[model samples]
Target: MKAKNGLNYESNPKHTPGGQGFRPNAGIEPVNSFELFGESVSVNLKDKIHKSRYTMDNKGNIHRFSPDNRGNYHWSGSTADKIKLNIPN
Candidate 1:
């Protein structure tokens, strides 16, 4: 099966027992930098299983990155309205 974004989901060998799979088709991208709360933050928004993950910086500020209903990824703590990432299929 193919997702709207053009990612193939049929018999993905990368699918693991933990429900986490890597999207090989969507080549990995470098960490993205964005401004949050008037400060620069580094967010690693890679394509992977649709799961919620959290990270914290040395300052103790927490950041959340998760998938939405459409399978697009977004990050929290950003001043912008919504930074949605739609990896190419």
Candidate 2:
């Protein structure tokens, strides 16, 4: 489905049994959302924001996380810093 940040954040058409592909059975994904603030901003302020987070954790399932709750999440130790990863692509 079309997401807030203009991405086709859809599930994998070929759902493999052991693949890390998406499961679009739900709605769109979060990383496909938009970023509202910069590193100079604060995390406390950003955490209160809604409509920006796409993933959900119910029961025991956990989706990926974007530090500061922005649209950029690094897979644990994927980087040394989260804010710096937002270097204009």
Candidate 3:
């Protein structure tokens, strides 16, 4: 999921009768919002860099999420609560 974000570049292929050429593909359109635990949270990408970001809650605890080069997402927060779930690709 993180790899699919706008931070990376993709290839745009153009084919003709004889050959094909490639160019840098544009990034996906920015997503301005997303749902979090059934609640819609606004997304802000203006200050976001690369493939990681941090979110802070009202209690002063910080939540963080980012993806590693190996295609696994790493998550850590100030709280110890854990939940079992899978994010389908």
> Which numbered prediction scores highest in lDDT against the true structure?
1
lDDT of each: 0.35, 0.29, 0.31
State how far residue 13 of model 2 sits from its true place (Å). Answer: 2.1
Clashes of each: 0, 0, 0
Q: Decide which is better by TM-score, 2 or 3.
A: 3
Which ten residues in a row are the worst by lDDT in model 2?
Answer: 33-42
Q: In candidate 2, which residue pairs get closer than 3 Å at backbone N, Cα or C atoms, i.e. clash?
A: none
* Candidate 1 least-lDDT 10 residues: 33-42
lDDT of 1 by residue, 1-89 (tens): 33333432222222222335654433222233122212322344555443543444455545444445674444433212133233322
lDDT, candidate 1, equals 0.35
Residue pairs whose backbone atoms clash in candidate 3: none
- After superposition, which runs of candidate 3 have C-alpha atoms over 4 Å from their true positions? 1-48, 70-72, 77-89
Worst 10 residues of 3 by lDDT: 29-38
State candidate 1's TM-score. 0.28
Candidate 3 TM-score to native? 0.27
Enumerate residue pairs that collide in model 1. none
lDDT of 2 by residue, 11-84 (tens): 33222234465343322332322221111122233456432222323332223323434334322111122322
Q: TM-score of every model?
A: 0.28, 0.22, 0.27
